[model samples]
Target chain A: MKLPLLFTDELRGFYKSKLMLILWIGLPIIALLFRFAQTTSTGQDIPFTVISTIVISSLAGTLSSVMLAVSIINEKNRNVYTLFLIRPLKRRELLLAKFLSVYICVTIASLLAVFVGMTTDYITTGMLSTKLIDNTAQSLVTSLSMLAVSCAAGVLIGVASPSVMVGAILVIYGGNQISVIPLMPTILNITYATLFTTTTTLLTCSLLLIAAIGLFERKQF
Target chain B: MSPRNFRNQFVVLREVTKKYGGLTALKKISFEIGEGEIFGYIGPNGAGKTTTMKILVGLLTDFEGEVYIGGFQVPKQKSEVHKLLGYLPQSVGFQEWRTVDHALKTFGKLSGLTETEIEKRITEVLDLLALSEVRHKKIAQLSGGMTQKVGLGQAILHNPKLLILDEPLNGLDPLSRYQFKEVLLKLSKGGTTILFSSHILSDVQDVADRIGIINRGQIKQVGTLNELKEHLAEQRTVEVLLTYATDKWREFQNIKHVKSVEQPSVGRILVNIEKGSDPDDVMNDLAQLIVKQKIRIRGINLLSPSLDDIYQKYVQEGESI
Candidate 1:
């Protein structure tokens, strides 16, 4: 009960944040620009759908991670969680709420970007190719999985970093890199992309989120 | 007597001790606050006032003590205790992107109030805290005093039985402070038990039904205002105002039972009397000495110790030890 309430509260907060505004409006624009660039170029083999998925995922995931890390560090420093902790809310719920909200927002933005890119692909080419659809689906799944890992890593950094500067630095330098690890097995073609990515995403995200919750529970504030 | 023996005690701490690494933030402290009573937890900086409040609210779980709030043990039955407790931390910040109404609504909902109850409480809290006009304003746009009021507003939005406020009055202006005190008094009258911590003596003296003086992480004393004042009643002083700027009042120092005499101003002399001496007898001797010395006196009166004196004495004692 409390988790949902806190998650809703955090969702509302993130929904109104400047970062969400940028993601909502900026990501689709970036997708359109990538589609326009691909259409203008001759002999372009890469589909805009696949291109936009990776681009949007990388951009949205990094920005969201930084935003999550900095906000968490700032709120912790400001003792914002004190009021929540004093309520019936658990510390893990607070972290989980933040993770879920940011991940959901980023996922929505990524989907919007990919959808816009796919729509443009269909309008330009006159029909949606099965191969293009298959590639888009694969890229979208991998991107979302990587995003889950990135968001969880962002939460871990937020919980561990002592200050906003340090949190942001860690998220930018080390946190975003976590997204690529799950993608590695797929990139190498060593295993089934969907199975491996989903397994790795669940395992890594759970580990990072559990570590974050442990740190948060032990935190003094 | 043990704090547990108090009738209707809403909060109790028995031998509460907390340490951080090598430094003990709270000693073996003990105190009790009865139902609906305003308990002022007063102390200087780093005196463990915040620590004690945190423990009571179940924020600080690593401590040695027996703490019970509304019959629920702290950190053990914290969830049940949380239902009956409202806490305003010493220094807290809201998500800056939230409007005043949004923040309160979130807190109201998290406190388990129904939607209708949340809306009603939001309206009531905003009006009570004089925040109705700023209901739509973002928290970052509000002034420091307004922000503090918002902090208070959320704490009381659910109307819990016990409220624990740490330095709730730190950033308020004079008018806001007066209004905040009035709100507290009104809440207390409505049967809400409040334990607020502050270094400001006058504020505590004004609102606290019982004051607890904590220093060096120890409960130095806890009693009603008058009871604490009576603790230092024996060490009394007499203030004398002379008709003219003359040093003749200095002669009272030689009178019986007079401990010392010093002229603080040209026409004012403060006489310190012996601890066990009868103040009436000392005043009599001073009056007789004034007449014998042919000094015209305008007024002379015994001075009772103010809260400032009591606070200073206890805090200074804590420092020295």
Candidate 2:
């Protein structure tokens, strides 16, 4: 009963937020602009779909990190959670509701941007290549994993930090930077880099979620 | 429901102590609220009124000792207790982006009400609290009074058995405060057990069946207005209205058991009854003296201590508001 109510309420709240609009419409427009700017400078064919996918996935990571962090901190400081906590609601359920709502919204926005980039490329190139598909798919998976880790880290910071500014700083500078740790072996040209990155990212997300839930449960609000 | 439990206790706190870091927020507080009783918790700022309310609402689980609501242990059977509770947190903030109706709907759903039942309750509470006109307006655009009403509305949306309101009238205008008090009284009359906190003595005195005054994280006293005044009966006053004014009323001070006498107005004499003196006996003696003095008498009235006096006397030493 509570999960649906909390989830729907959070979705409505974030969907109408100014930051969500920036992620939804502004990110896609920026990706299209980057694609156009690239064709004029490089002269050689570069897949606009691939470029847009990479740009959007990256934006999702950084944006979701800051957004979820600031949102949770503000809610905590304002004591908005008090209304829910005093009811028959669980601490884990509250955190999970917020996490799932933000995650789903950010995921949809990222995919939309990727779709726009793919459509733009198809329109311009008149053909899609197998290698390009492989590269775009790989980037999509990496971006999503990084985004998940960043979102979880954002929750951890929001729960642990005593102030909103500190939480935001941790999310923007610390969490955004650390989200790339799982992908580090790829730069070193290691074999099975994808497997290593995915496992470590999921484990890190699990730990961060556990920590967030524990802190929230013990928090006095 | 009957107004009395087997032991006449609907809520009980036993040696309930709460501490924050090194500071004790509540020091071995113990009290009982009878079934269907309107229990007012009053204290100065930071006097642990909110802390006690939070513990009762199950929002604070780290406190020592136990609190029972309807014989169920709190924070352990918190979810079960929640079914019977409606809380309006002090200075609570709603999602300002939501309309009043939407906010109520969310809370109603969380309280486990069906859609049809919630809709009916929405209409009932909005009309009851005079919030019908602003039901569709966003909370961000509401006045403080309107927001307070919304908080109250959500609390009562499920018609809870126990209503815990912390400073529900803190920032309301006088008219709104009066209206809120009426709502509380109406709920109490309908068999709801209300535990509300306020610093406004008049508001507490008006609606409370019993009052608890806390100071320095300890409960100073708890009783009905009459009971508290009777407890502090060392000094009492009787006001007498005479047909004519007199400066010679000071002579009556010499009468036995009469501590002092003053003419607050030309024809009104206020006589202070000394401690341990039977006010009835003193009044009988004073009547004979007044008759002998040939003072044309209009009326003699005993004045009870006001709630302000009682609250101040109990909360501090020899302090009067």
Output the number of the DockQ-best candidate.
1
Interface root-mean-square deviation of model 2 in angstroms is 1.2
What TM-score does model 1 achieve against the real structure?
0.94
Tens digit of per-residue lDDT, candidate 1, span B154-224: 99999999999999999888899999999999998798999998878899888988889999999998998
lDDT of 1 by residue, A12-62 (tens): 787677667778889989877766676678656466788789786788889
Candidates in order, TM-scores: namely 0.94, 0.94
Residue pairs in candidate 1 whose N, alpha carbon or C atoms collide under 3 angstroms: none
Candidate 2 has an lDDT of: 0.84
- Lowest lDDT block of 10, candidate 1 chain A: A38-47
Candidate 2, what DockQ? 0.70
Off by over 4 Å in 2: A18-21, A40-45, B1-7, B241-247, B262-269, B296-299, B318-321
What docking class should model 2 receive?
A: medium
